[model samples]
Target: MQSTYTEGLNPEQKKAVLHHDGPLLILAGAGSGKTRVLTHRIAHLVEEKGVAPWQILAITFTNKAAKEMRDRLERMVGARVHDMWVSTFHASCVRMLRSHIEKLGMGYHSNFVIFDSADQQTVVKSCVKELRLSDANFPPRGVLSVISNAKNEMLTSDRFQSLNAADYRLSKIADIYTRYQRILVQSNALDFDDILMLTVQLFEKHPDVLTSYQDKFRYILVDEYQDTNNVQYLLVSQLAKRYRNICVVGDDDQSIYKFRGADIRNILDFEKDFKDAVVIKLEENYRSTQHILEAANQVIKNNRGRKGKTLFTQKTSENKVTLLAAGDEHEEARMVAEHILWLKSTTDYAFKDFTILYRTNAQSRVFEDVFLRQAVPYRIYGGLRFYERKEIKDIMAYLRLV
Candidate 1:
């Protein structure tokens, strides 16, 4: 078949685009054309492989990324691409579960709401209030965190009891988890964990349903594949056990979501999971200067147990990294603000060009306060994501109804 993606890409990228055999893992470095490769791969699947749009599943990490991929696919194949599965992990799972909720004893056209951290805390607070637990002794947030952990690991109340240690707090949290799931089910709701776990259960019990979906989807592509949790891994594994035509793209060095139950083992054991997996490294970076890529590569080299590869950029510009030491916290903020102000005033740099990154979202508060005091135009990124927005939730609820 003739190729549609070879028009703009160079020879190396064209090679990656054309190679469509077995389970492919594109180990893309930062600032690499990972999105370009993914979109081109989808286009190649349709145009070259003759795969229908409904037979493709493109899983992304964030709603923004999913939206971008959907937009790109739409541009590639126009309106026909809208029928394909392209969304975040949670969003896609929710859609899948909602379609076959009856197999898992869940009601169809039900209100299966997904609660974020704050929403879960609210539920926990209500549970604590009903249980008459002391807030001083047992914080709702702490209880919710424990419950969330258990759910992320796909542990049921019975399983939790079997493995429950002698810790009174853990026991109490398990009891709360059982109660929480019961409440969620009664309210016709399912949190993020329930989405995948329920779908897996449905697939296991209902053979015909599973076969129908398995026959429908011919190719599955997952982005940020290293960040898949246990439930997500299980869901993908079950779906691909029949066809085994799955392609996962990710960088092992950039797997930074362990705290939220993301198992890096998924990436490490890709060969064991999928026999004779084809590993392709896209080491040619398109973003950033050569010097910046060197610094990033050096910093990431400190991380051990990674699929080793050196990233190089074709751009020859030299961008040097700057280090500053300040005596106090306030002084550090003041220094950064002054530096940004100086850059904005002297150079053609705009206020939007500069960003302050920190380890935790809490660290952004001091900089935000300092920037406000200095009357600088800056935006702090934190809190609920775009998919967690009220409008998006409402729209999803409506779609779930339909």
Candidate 2:
């Protein structure tokens, strides 16, 4: 008996979608239709499992992923999808804080402003200047990073101070963190890290609020569980403490946000955390060829900390994966440009069909230069080329002032 929502899902995906009770862990491999599983599970819960839409809380890593899940659920479950709580972790925190922030006795009203990175930097710079700290020794960005990391680890300014009392540099950073928090409070504002940190604080300090939410959202689903930091893990743990009906979807091999304080142990220790949890591995990839999956599996299997799963695909392609080596970034860019040109000249592919990816934005300069010199017209995706211009930034600053 296949429900409308669960139709066409693979056995592993169906197992993940149908298991509505208890803690579940879905080891979703790359291109393995994890999004489909997530969306279909929500739809199945609402459409077939007789679960109230409001009882489900589906959390993802990014706003875009959240929106995509919501849109997919809407197509399957009609307007009832609106009742389901589908949002990024930050968004969910913001929503909760809006209702219960003042309850924390933090002097912040529901209308507190959420400061962006720029605003946070401005405040950090002001704190540094007021404290008479040398800019070179205690850079604003460095100070902010410390504060952000502390928040990610669920450490308050005082707690961080106490923990790092022996370290002189951290002691100074603790002072900056304390003052920076005071200024944010005075301004009736919170930065991104504060959003998560305060929500955890709100839940911890106010048990009634936590209980209400815990009772309301009976089923909790978190995407990208591998990328959750300590604070995020605590937040989810608190909310799902009562129901214990939590489902986390992540590939430990794909955990790549360590620099952003993502703790891989959250996903790795899922079984230990929920001893009775059901684990399903979604290893059937639909996007890549068999050869590519084999190559990726070989590389990823070397990671000792991961929950082991090998990805397999039905797609058959004889093309072998090519390994390219270059002396430096310049040579790499040139090699890429030359290869792309060669492909365009030999094959029927157009320039629009070929896409180049790099590790960071800084690495794009070499590629952009090479492409320009080679007369290869290219567009940078996700780069703020226009808004990041000096004149454009100046105009924006002036507008904000006016």
TM-score of each: 0.87, 0.94
User: What are the per-residue Cα lDDT tens digits for candidate 1 across 1-402?
Assistant: 358786777665676677675677778888778888889988888877888889988989899999999999899988878878999878877777767786666454444677676776777777777777777767877777666677677788768866785777777777777777777777777776777777777788898888888888778889999898888888788777777888888889889999888999898888888877888888888877888888888998888788888889788865587778999778888999999999999999998898887787656656766888899976546664444569878998999999
For candidate 1, what is the TM-score? 0.87
Lowest summed-lDDT stretch of 10 residues in model 2?
383-392
Q: Which pairs clash inside model 1?
A: none
Clashes of each: 0, 0
CA deviation > 4 Å runs, candidate 1: 106-119, 341-346, 350-352, 368-377, 381-402
Candidate 2, 135-207: lDDT as tens digits? 8999888888899999998899999999999998999899999999999999999999999999998888989
